[model samples]
Target: MSPTIRSLVIPVTDLAAAKAVYTALLGAPHTDESYYVGYNVDGFEVSLNPSGDTAGPVAFADVDDLDAARESLLAAGATEQSAPRKVAPEARVCVLADGDGNPIGLRGR
Candidate 1:
């Protein structure tokens, strides 16, 4: 299954500050903003989640076959963090970390 980037979530301590930076970086006013803001850009979605802890980004994607995708990653030297699990009617996903410990997600509807 060929995967495509779906969303990128950035945890932020100050939503307004982060929004300003990202808005300028993207060079466009936010497409959507609320207490929880979401931006749909270039077939990739950007979202900001508020938190007090240090921020980090999470990359999400679409996969035709999540199970097969996970297997392929393992074969290619990725370590599984969580086995695939259903998220109910909406979708399913699995978690893995590459050799460098960056998270990689496998997801399907």
Candidate 2:
């Protein structure tokens, strides 16, 4: 299944600072939680993750079938960084690394 990027996640050392900056920049309110802070700007989802790596921002793609998408990416020279894990009752996510070690995220419901 083809996947479309739907979310952009940014790792931050300070959640509050990041949230404030993003909120002002996006001019949108955010859902504040202990682990994550999220905002919907225009048609894009922007999130601040406290537990994410500092390497760079990760773009999460929505796929119809998570498993199939993971397999397809792996076969295309991507390495699995994390296995599928449930984020919500009916939603799951996974992470993969390209040959250059850039992280990519996949989400499915």
TM-score of each candidate structure, all chains considered together = 0.61, 0.90
Q: lDDT score of model 2? A: 0.87
Q: Residues 72-96, candidate 1, lDDT per residue (tens digit)?
A: 8899999986678785487886678
| lDDT score at residue 77, model 2, on the 0-100 scale | 98
Give Cα-based local distance difference scores for all models.
Answer: 0.73, 0.87
Q: Which one is best on lDDT?
A: 2
Provide backbone clash counts, one per model.
0, 0
